[model samples]
Target: MTTVQQSFPVPPQVLWNALPAGVTAIGGQGPFYDAQRGYVTCRTGMTFFSWGQVVTAMVSPAAQGSTITVQTALKFGVFDWGEGKRLGTRFATAVAYAAGTAALT
Candidate 1:
């Protein structure tokens, strides 16, 4: 599994609102958010991918704003050929774009 974690100044609710659009931008569907757990899950429509390329976005309180992590695993393979990293980058980019942030780390 590969994970992309980023910190932003937006609150969880704001991030939650941006999630669906962001996920859709990356060919993801059925985004589900758990407020209690601060988790958002979805399935990606990535090519060469079976076994449900799941993406999990986690949000937590941060000193400045909030920290969000989007994690994905490439099933049925030991190596993803950087696909996991690409997925993370895509998700982070969407979120950052929605949040109106200058950039993500």
Candidate 2:
């Protein structure tokens, strides 16, 4: 799995609410939020260079704001050739943009 973690100067709920939009911006599908689990999950579409990936964003409260940890893994392979990390970065950027914090990039 490829993981990307980021901290934002916003409430956990704010970041959590932006997860779906972030996923969609990355060309993900079926973004599902599990409030009880404190996470959002989505799947990437298949393309010529990839088989698809499962992306998960877990949000947690912080002292001042919030922190998000995003994990990306290939649906059917042991190696993703850095695609997972790329997708994770894009997801985080989109979430930051949606949350009105474009400085996260």
C-alpha RMSD values across all candidates? 2.0, 1.7
Model 1 alpha-carbon miss at residue 102, Å: 3.0
Q: On a 0 to 100 scale, what is the lDDT of residue 24 in model 2? A: 82
> Candidate 2, residues 40-66: lDDT per residue as tens digits?
889998866579999999999877688
lDDT of 1 by residue, 25-101 (tens): 67887888788897888887647645547888887778767887889886566777777778877887787788777
lDDT of 2: 0.86
lDDT against the true structure, per candidate, is 0.76, 0.86
lDDT of 1: 0.76
Give the lDDT of residue 6 in candidate 1. 82
Model 2: pairs clashing at backbone N, Cα or C within 3 Å: none
Q: What is the Cα-based lDDT of residue 74 in candidate 1?
A: 67
Clashing pairs in 1: none
